[model samples]
Target: MSKIALFGPTALELFGHTVHAPLQRRAITSERAAEFTPSKRVLDHVHSTFPFLSRPAHITVFDRKHRRQKYARCHLGTPALLNFDFLHVGDGILAPPPEVALVQAMRGRSVIQAAAQGSALCASYSLHADSPTIIQREPIATRASLEMVTRSCSSIPGCKTVRNALPWILPHAASPREIALGLVLFLPVRLGGYGLPRPTLNFPIPTGKHPGNLADRRYYVADLCWPHAHLIVEYDSDAFHLTSDQHYHDIVKRTTLESMGYHVITVSRRQLNDPSEMDKVAACIAKALQKEWRFRVRDFPTRQTQLWTILGLAPNR
Candidate 1:
């Protein structure tokens, strides 16, 4: 048997999928993998149960008591404070708790990458690197959970970055695109933020009755809303074109919001792809909020490019 090995992205990935459903970790292919690694029997059982684990480029081992020069790292602080957990992957792998794993994964990542991933962690979705890339429904972790972990692991790598990102992570993000949209809009200007105020995600407001519904619902939820500004931004996806019912429902919601004296802006993938169009949306937001539209940072253009590049909005990067 090898010593208990595994941490970092592997652990984050492990807990991430587990948040949705139990999954197995990839096997360690060596004898000297660690001081006390998961036994082959445990690995075999997990592989037989879940045969498809991601094979990382390198193996990672974590020592709760000591550190090694190459593969293993000394655990940060205490296990109790870190809230370390384990998975069935050979029964000895260290699967850091969702919150801790999330912050640890942020080590050396750029602000946008860290913030985007942090938001996704708190979101009711799971983003994957492979096909079907995003799973939307269950929230794997939350800002408050991450905050608790970071507070205890303050000296750990990436904890500060995660702490800086907490204020921007909203709750109940419905889709990957929504997460991207929110970050691009609300992150601080220093981090490629558009200087927009924080808006509640899927915020519900009383809009009185609408004829489009059988229930004559008196409230409608806005995709991204600034209550004080009375403005809402909705991402209009292609689904509306294919689903008449959804389209009609959205139309009614927009009409209701508009009738209630609120300014509404509908953003689409097409508009997002067009640089000038996004600027126009930002302008609309500024006008609604009654704020001057200006970039305070000296290297605003460079930071903006870096932000989009990290967010994957840069096509040529």
Candidate 2:
């Protein structure tokens, strides 16, 4: 039988054990001197074996019935070490050595590291296959996984606004699958539909000559171009309008392009949801193209007065 040590009050009560006479005398003697004085070799062994327990506030030694006495602590003790392979810890399971009890004690509070939490712990156990496996397989309950899943979900555009409302909307969704379903159904309708054209979605608008300008910095390059009109169409989604910085930058770019005789049309998320909006936008583009083509054909002024404003130059005849 493995020798078990009972540390705290609860451990002693459960195991029906008491502190060893010699260890208790040592504790009393150390307390009288107002300092602990365990042998250097014992202290060194403890420091090497269980690093976290080295400077704990208080320590005790307890003997289990029919078992040798082992060390305990007022602050930290694992259920495995307390009752000699009998009492299970957080998940109410007994684990074995080299699977060392000290390791379990240190990580008892962390649900992710607990054996009962699932395959993650199982994988860790497999890696240390030579170590003794904990006998009891109780599941450790923790909110960490749920929090991580929620954080990832919130990073998406429409989902950002609906994160707080998720629990109320779907209380049963503790796992990612249920949360994903809820997000799919709730987000699109809640934040409004995806209005932009899927084909041109996220296409970049390239600034022709001065690519280094701030106005062109954030824009992406699209394959399609209306070179004659210098027009660029950007299909905007909620994601595009996420931050004030992005929104302001987009406005500046649009103004700069328009000033350079380029007609820039931004199809926002809301406008895209309307079926007739695309037709209206298309008509505007056609008119702009016709105007540019007509000017080229008639040999009229190719540059507009807006170019002077855009380039910060004085208008000349």
Candidate 3:
């Protein structure tokens, strides 16, 4: 087995197994990296073999000896070098386990982006694939697994980032857009969300008793649900949701939930794109939950803007 484990964004790209976005890695992945630590000559030999490791983006690796190089950003000490875990994806190329890879991936990511990634790790689908449709797989890791690793590395800087990230994590989130909605709505008010209580993503409510459920759909899965409040917020993504048949399906689902005495709220991509519109939607939901939705912070606007930047929801200047 190769000891040249990929770390950082290079790992993330190969699934540091994170997201669906295009990854133009500036870092390197060397098969010869297995023999990287013996000497300068060995390292040079290893590095030279991978002519394709020419990307300009930084990729992290374990290099305590601190050998100088163009692309590798070495993690000299702490967890990445000593305590983290790894697994083989294929071809004898070892990769840091999901929990470890996620910890490494968070180094350069904004808070919301990292939270989404962490949550995605707990999900049951693969974001990295050649097909447009996300494929189903056993969850690569769990919130508990991440927590275990984070606690083990508490003294490390990345651990604190992971700690800060815990509050916003929605372990059951199903899509990137769903993650965006959860962060914007449930993240603390200081972090640019409305400060709503965290909701369970894709919570299943049994409809087995309702005879009117003639469609034989046995469960109504809420995109974001506050079970205690019986409130659900559904994200109607712009993709595949604009069709007439999908619109009818949504109407039926909303009516079905309302009939069951649950308050249903819908958030569309357009509303999420426009902050003012989203605020109105938040207000409507808050009214349903009997919570006052108001901001008292003086720099709230600037902070929320930064949050937008973090979420990649802000428009380009």
lDDT per residue as tens, model 2, 157-180: 222322332232322222222222
lDDT tens digits, residue span 1-317, model 1: 44454455655655444436335433333333344433445445434443445543112443443443333343433333323433444444435456766666788876577677777666776655345556665776777887888888876688888888788787777776787778878887888668788878878887655454332366887888998888899988665465777767877777777877789998898766555567788888888888788888998667777777777674322
Best by lDDT: 3
The local distance difference test score of each candidate is: 0.65, 0.32, 0.66
Where does candidate 2 stray beyond 4 Å?
Answer: 1-224, 239-241, 291-317
Q: What's the TM for model 1?
A: 0.77
The order by descending TM-score is 3, 1, 2
lDDT of 3 by residue, 220-263 (tens): 88999999999999988674647887777777778778878789
- Stronger candidate by lDDT (1 vs 3): 3
The candidate with the higher TM-score, 2 or 3, is 3
RMSD to the true structure for each prediction, in A, is 5.4, 24.4, 5.9
Candidate 1 vs 2: which has more TM-score: 1
* Local error of candidate 3 at residue 224 (angstroms): 0.5
TM-score of every candidate: 0.77, 0.25, 0.80
